[model samples]
Target: MTFNLETERLILRDLRMSDLEGMFELDSDPEVHKYLGNKPVKTKEESQKIIEAVIDQYEKYGIGRWALINKKTGEFMGWSGLKLNTKMNGITNFYDVGYRLIKRFWGQGYATESGKKAVDYGFKVLKLPELYGITEMEHQASHHALLKIGLKYIEDFYFEEEKIKLRWYKIENK
Candidate 1:
């Protein structure tokens, strides 16, 4: 299934093969992945595989991370949307909201903007009971954005798989 969502200055849409370059640029940057295990993709093929995996999620789950595009410049800023995070860190599978933008676009409020929209989509459109956001404990920027988008910090716990402590945030549809 195909999807598109718009905010005041961004367009969130399904990932496509044409997004390879933008995805590579976003994923290859060490700064961009600093809070994400600090492991940047080494090749364009890796980015291609990431896109393919998201596409498969769209088919299987009806939702996944959407490409974040600058509506005005038509630039691919990165991606932000909802994902069904299946059992990881001993946490049961749950719907989560996430975002990633180019380092250049880091401080422009794009993450919170798109994240709020994703939360809306999750609750109103998908009818999910709750949504979550997880970030490395030191990622204050992401922590702030998640709060700004309405998620409240619930706990800090160790993710055995990554061997890192993470902050888990959540928001529920009342």
Candidate 2:
């Protein structure tokens, strides 16, 4: 069964193939995709594959990225949730809280609300020992959200793939 998580103004749920267009729009914004990836998704197929992969991840790992929806209008805003990032150094293979909201929805506290809920879900439902999040050094917005969710900055480094300096934030369940 697909996981459906809700908050006051947002709904986080399994991504559907139909979400590709909206997802592409979100990824296309250079400001939105800046820290997450160096580029926007070039094709609808790429978005579809990514959504399908997220679906598989949810089924296999019991937790994965959830598509963010606007509760008021039922519009696809973006995605936010937890997943295992096996490539990271300190907290590889653990739930990593993340979010990508559209430009229109920026600065509404949706990211923080969703992130807080995600952290609680990791600890209470998934029973994970920790929750972590990563943001580029220049991303003050995300850094603030991390702090709001009780995550402390743990490291600063550059990833070879993105070639960008990043700051890692983490919080242990304990």
Candidate 3:
């Protein structure tokens, strides 16, 4: 079944082929990719592939990041939710809470709001023991949102593959 969730002003649901336009709008912006490897998607096909990958994750792992939509405006804002991360950061088979919003939606508290819902789902609904978050070390906005959603700063680690340092955060199911 497709995942669906609601907050005060947003609706979180499974990513679909229909979201290609919005996905492209969100991922093709250079500003949105500044902290995310400085690589914004150059074409709509790349955005299509991304949505496909997330759809595959749902079929394989039973969970994946969901599309974030404005409840009132019916606008596709971006995506947020939990993903099963494997063999990243020396951790295996763990849940990661993440979010990305359209640039215009930034600073509007959407990240923090949706992140909290993802954490709650991981702990309460999925019965996960812990959840993790990774952000570029210099991303102050993400740092604030992760912390606000109750994740504690763990440490900075260098990702050998990406050749960049990142900050790790975590929250236990306690």
All models, RMSD in angstroms: 0.8, 1.3, 0.7
Where does model 3 exceed 4 Å of error? Answer: none
Candidate 2 Cα deviation (angstroms), residue 29:
1.9
Check candidate 1 and list the clashing pairs: none
Query: Which sequence of candidate numbers ranks them by lDDT, best first?
Result: 3, 1, 2
TM-score of each candidate structure, all chains considered together = 0.98, 0.94, 0.98
Question: Candidate 3 lDDT (Cα, whole model)?
Answer: 0.95
Residue-wise lDDT of candidate 3 within 100-164, one digit each (tens)?
A: 99999999999999999999888888899999999999999999999999999999999998888
**Clashes per candidate (backbone, < 3 Å):** 0, 0, 0
Which candidate should be chosen as best, given lDDT against the real structure? 3
The predicted structure with the larger lDDT, 1 or 2, is 1
lDDT of 2 at 127: 88
TM-score sort, best first = 3, 1, 2
| Model 2 C-alpha lDDT per residue in residues 84-174, reported as the tens digit of each score | 8888754457668998899998888989999988998899998888887889899899999889988999989878777778998889998
lDDT tens string, model 1, 1-174? 789899999999999999999999999999999999989999999999999999999999999999999999999999999999887656687988999998999999999999999999999999999988999999999999999999999999988888888999989999
Clashing pairs in 2: none
